[model samples]
Target chain A: MIELSDVHKSFGSKDVLRGVNLTLPKGESMVIIGGSGTGKSVLLKCVLGLIQPDTGSIAVDGQDVTRLRQGSSERDAFLARFGMLFQGGALFDSLPVWQNVAFRLLRGSLKRPKSEAREVAIEKLRRVGLTPDVADLFPAELSGGMQKRVGLARAIAAEPEIIFFDEPTTGLDPIMSGVINELIREIVVEMGATAMTITHDMSSVRAIADDVAMLHGGVIQWSGPVKDMDASGDPYVTQFISGSADGPIETVR
Target chain B: MSFLATIGRTVLGFLAAIGSVTLFAMETVSHLFRPPYYPREFGHALLQIGYFSLPVVGLTTIFTGGALALQIYAGGARFSAEAVVPQIVAIGMVRELGPVLVGLMIAARVTSSIAAEIATMKVTEQIDALTTLSTNPMKYLTLPRVLAATLVMPVLVGVGDVIGIMGGYLVGVERLGFNASTYLRNTVDFLEFLDIVTSLAKGAVFGFLAALMGCYFGMRSGRGAQGVGRATKGAVVAASVLILAANFILTELFFAA
Candidate 1:
């Protein structure tokens, strides 16, 4: 289980996250939806310990992750159990696809033999619908959708206990988006991993989210199951669901 | 009062920058002796920073050497002391010109490349990815380049010194009507061990500052293309200025009696 309590973050007086409180049960798929610049990404980063909150507690499995010292052995061990798919895929351009996928297996405490690591990379690539031949190419050569798949493959390669996907369906065509959403749903269910995904794409939310959390004004405005999202009578949720521009929630801000 | 306020702000910003850079340097050096060293990355950095930089360093030093010889010959002619060309060229190349010129060339070539590459990586979030993968960016990225440049710089300076002296020899024997054997002998005999050692030491220090500046600016770069452009420009400028400044200090320490 992951829990965030009263999380607040500000950048030079511009509050990005304000007193955000949310929770995800173990092995649950929680999707955070919000408008652009509403701190959806910041909420995810706070949980991942990538961004430190101003005054809050982030507990993963009842352990306060935010308080862990940077570069500590405990922090490293905690990070090792997480798989993150960054918004841009964040593939190391200089390395080949296989090496990037097998990066965790190749170095540090999780070191594996080169041959074994390569084999695992190929297997993971196949799991994401990539051919063995694609393993040799660089990230620059792949299309945006393909890069996202590679990023997904790399994320699950370590068989992490938790996975965080940041805007996974962004910048893809509708067909590709559907494909990725289905892939994520299938993978999360099969792996039984605790997953947190941030996306505004309703299709992705319906396909992957067990619970949907609407982030607005730096706080979770509504939280419930995907089925309840449509009928949630809160004006903000209603306005968001209907894609209405004029409502209690000001679109201009 | 407004002008004074602006001046104060500028002075404070400069000091803050120095402080941040100093802390970053300390962090990088601290990680240097720790475990989980990436020898493969270090080797690649060596090939990139040291071997690949030979052409530029060589070209600059050689031309400087040749020009130094010509100037020394012409100047010495005014006093009928033309024979001092070989000794002056040898001493100049071995003691100061060789290392300083090579250092600046590296600042231009290696520092800018390192900064641009790292800044792009930061912009693309690859550095963050590395951190998430249980890797330290300082160790994986900065240490390799810094160590490689530091270790390889003396070798580069040694090579540059020889090439520069050879350039002076070419100019002296061919253009200045000096005997080739006598020029070579004077050049060889005039250079002292202290001069060579000081040159190599300067090379090491200059290389460290150059690569450190690159990593510092690159890691601190802000978001987007503009951030990357600023990082690259800042790195080259900082590296060049630091190299020149360090050269003066090192020269004073070495030669001031």
Candidate 2:
């Protein structure tokens, strides 16, 4: 289980995340949706311990991750169980596809022998719908969809207990996004990983998430099962679901 | 007022970056002496930061040496002492220009490259990916570069010192009227081991400063191409200023007597 209690974050004086409280039951996929700058990404980052919250307790599997600073042995142990997919796919340009996929398996304290790691990398790449030949190529050589797949492969390579995805479908075509959403759903079920994904893509939410949370005004405005999202009476939810400009959520400019 | 604010902000940012680098560097240096060091990464960093820096450092120093020869020749003729070419060239290049010129050259080459590359990685989220893989980016990326720059700079300075001397000798023998043996003798007689040591120390400090600026700005970049551009620009400016500042202090310490 993962939980955020009364989270608050500020940059300079502007609040990005304000008193955010949420929870996810074990092995559930929760997709957080909001317009740009509504703090969807900030919420994900807070959970991942990438950006520390000013006042919050982010607990993962009963561990207070937000307070655990990096470089501590305890923090290292804490980090051992989490996987994350960044918005841009974040594959190391310098490393080949296989190396990027199996990065966690091959580097630092988790490092295995080179040959074994290579085999594992290739296997993970295959699992991501990539060919064995593609494993030798660098990320710059791959298409955007391929890169996302590689990122997904890397996230699940270690069989992490939890996974976080940030705007996973932001750049892909709707078809490719659907394909990735299906893959994510399958992987979550197969790995039995508790997953939290932040995205504005309604199609992605419809395909992958078990629960949908709407972030607005720096807090979760509404949350429930995917079936409840369209029927939700909240104006914000209606406007967002219909993708209309004339509702509670309006364009900033 | 805006211009002053710009200067103040730049100074503050530079200081903050230096402080952060110092703290991280302390942790990295501690790791350096501890067990479980990454020998392979260290070797690669040495090649990248030091060995690769030579061409730029060498070319910069030699040309500066040649230019110094000409300038000193012109100035000394004011005193009818144009014969001081050998001594002045050796002294200027070795004592001041050699390390400073190399430092500035590296600030232009290595700092910008490191900043732009790392900043791009950061904006692309690759650094975050490194963390998810249980690899500390600081340990893997910044530490090796810092260690390599610190270790290999003395070697670079030694080579630069020799090349710079040769530059002066070539100019003196070919362009000026000085005999080869006299110029060589003056160069040898005028230079002390302290001068060489000072230059080497400057080299290490400047090299560390340059790489430190690079890594610091890169890690701190905001996002996107604009962020990376700012970081690159900041790194070069910071590296150049720090190099000059460190050179002055080291000069005072070495030759204050």
Candidate 3:
């Protein structure tokens, strides 16, 4: 289980996350939805310890994550349990696709033989609908959708216990977005991994989430199952899901 | 009062920048001695920062050597001391021009490349991805380049010294009407061990500063294309100025007596 309690983060004087509290039970799929610049990404990064919170506690399996010393064996072991797909794919431009996918298996404490690592990478690529030929190409050579698939392939390559997807279908076409959403749903269910995805795409939320959390004003305005989201009477959630411009939640802000 | 306030802010910003750079340098050094070293990354950096830089470093030093020979010959002629060309060129190339020119060339070439590459990675979130994959960015990205540049610079300086002296020797023998054998002999006999040692030492220091500046600016770069551009420009400028400043201080330390 992952728990965030009263998480508050600010950059300069601009507070991005204010007293955010949420929880994801083990092996559950929780999707966080919010408008742009509403600190959805910041909230995710805080849980990953990529951004330190001003005054909050983030506990993964009851252990405080922020206290883990960087570069220590404990920290490495902790990080090894996570798989993250960044918004832009974030593939290593200098390396070929297979190497990028097999990066975790190829180095550090999880070192594997080169041949074995390559085989595993190819298998993971196949799982994400990429061919073996695509393995030799660099990230720059791939299209945006192909790069997203590659990023997904890398995320699952390590078979991590937890997966975080940040705006996974942001730049893809509707068809491709559906394909990726289906892939994510299938993979998460098959792997039984704890998943936290942040996206404003309602299609993605319906396809991939077991529970939906609406983040507004740096806090969870509403939290419930996907079925309950439609009938929930909260004005903010209603306005956001309907994509209404004028409501109690001001879009101008 | 407003002008004084602006001046004070500028001074404080400059000092803060220095402090940040110093801390970054110390962090890089600490990571150097830690385990989980990436030999493959280090080898690639060696090729990128050292071997690939030969043409620029060679070209800069050779032309400067030829120019130094011509100027020394013309200046010596005014005193009827034209025969001093070979010794002066050799000393100048071995002691000063060779290291400084090679250092600046590296600052222009390697430092800018490192900064741009790293800044792009940062912008793309590859550095953060590395963290998620259980890797430390400083260990995986910064240490290898810093170590490779520091180890390979002395060799580059030594090669630059030889090429520069050869340029001077060619100019002396062909353009200045000196006997080839006599020019070579004078050039070889005039250079001392301390000159070569100082040159290599300067090369090492310059290489460290250059790579350090690149990593520092790249890591601290802000978001977007403008940030990457600023980081690249800042890295080259800082590395070049620091190399020149370090050269003067080292010269005083080595030869003040």
Candidate 4:
């Protein structure tokens, strides 16, 4: 389980996260939805310890993540249990597809032999719908959808207990987005990993989310299960779901 | 008062930048002693920074040495002491031209390339990916390049010094009516061990500055194409200027009367 309490972050004088409080139980998929620049990414990064919050507490599995030092053994052990798929694939351009997938296994605490790592990478690639031939190719050689799949493969290769997906379906076409959403849903279920995904794609929310959280003005405007999202009777949730420019949420930054 | 405030702001910014770079260099050096060293990355950096840099370093030094010989001959002739060509060329090449020229060449070639490559990596989020994978960017990226450049620069300088003296030798014997054996003898006889040592030391310093500036600018770069462009330009300029400034300081320390 993951928990956040009164999380606040500010950049200079501009406050990004005013006060965020949320929780995700184990083996659940929670999707966060908001307009552009609503600090959806910042909220996720805060949980990952990529961005430090000004105030608040984040705990994963009863361990206070805020107290863990960067580059510490404890922090490393903590990070080992979690995986993240970036908004952009963020694949290493210099390494081949297999190496990128097997990166965690090839180095650090999860060190494995070269041949074994390669085999594991190939297997993960297959799981993500990539062929064995694709292993030898570079990230640049793959299409955006293929790269996303590769990123997904890399995120799951370690079999991390928790996974975070940041705007996973942003740049893909509708068909590809559907495929990715289905893959994410299946992977989360099969792995039984606690997953937190942030995206504005309603199709993705319906396809992948077990629970939906609406983030607006750096706070959760509404929180409920996927089925209750439409009938939640919250104006903010209604405006966001209907994709209306005219609503309680301002369109302009 | 407003003018004074603006000047103060600029001065503070300058000092802050220096402090930041110093911290970065210290962190990079600290990683040198840590575990999980990447030997393959270090070897690749050696090839990229040292081996690939040879042709440009060689071509530049040869032409500069040839030009130095001509200038020294013309100046020595006006003093009715044209026989001093071999001695002056040897001293000039070994003490100043060889190291300085090689340093500037590296700033132009290796510095820009490192800055551009690392900056692009930053923009593309590869650095973050490395961090998530438990690989420190300082260890995997900066240390290998910096260490490779620092170690190989002395060798490059030695090679440049020899080639440059040969350039002078060719010009002296063929174009200026001097005997080949005599010019070569004069060149070898005039150069002291101290001059060569100082030259190599300067090469190491210059090389350190070159790679350090590249990594520093690259890691701090902003987002996108404009950011990468600015980082590359800033790195080359900073490396080149630091090399020249360090040359002056090292020269005054080594050869001061």
lDDT by residue for model 4 (A16-80), tens: 89899999999999999999889999999888787899999999988889888877888888888
TM-score of chain A of each: 0.98, 0.97, 0.99, 0.99
Order of candidate numbers by DockQ, starting with the best: 3, 1, 2, 4
Candidate 2 Cα errors over 4 Å, as ranges: B1-36
Question: Could you give candidate 1's per-residue lDDT for residues A1-253 as a string of tens digits?
Answer: 9999999999888999989899999999999998999999888878777788999899999999999987889999999999999999999998999999999999988899999999999999999899999999999999999999999999998999999999999999999999999999999999999999999888899999999999999899999999999999988888887889978888787
lDDT (Cα, tens digit) per residue for candidate 1, span B1-257: 99999999999999999999999999899997787899989999999999999998889888989999999999998999999999999999989899999999999999999999999999988998998998889999999999899999999999999999989989988998899999989988888999999999999999999999999999988899999999999999999999999999999999997
**Number of the top-ranking candidate, with DockQ as the measure:** 3
Docking class of 1: high
Tens-digit lDDT track of model 4 for B51-112: 99999988998898889889999998898988988999899999999999999999999999
Which is better, 2 or 3, measured by DockQ?
3
Q: Tens-digit lDDT track for model 3 on A126-157?
A: 99999999999999999999999999999999
* DockQ comparisons of all candidates to the true complex: 0.85, 0.69, 0.92, 0.64
Q: Which 10 consecutive positions of candidate 2 chain B have the poorest summed lDDT?
A: B31-40
Off by over 4 Å in 4: none
Error of 2 at A164 (Å): 1.1
Where does the lowest 10-residue lDDT sum fall in candidate 3 chain A? A244-253
State the lDDT of candidate 2 residue by residue for B1-257, as single tens digits.
Answer: 99999999999997985688788667766766654455767798788778888888788778777777888899999999898899888888889888888788878988898899889999988888777677777777777777788778878888888888888788778887779899999999999888888888899998888888898889989988899999999999989998999999989888899
Task: Assess candidate 2 and give its TM-score to the true structure.
Answer: 0.94
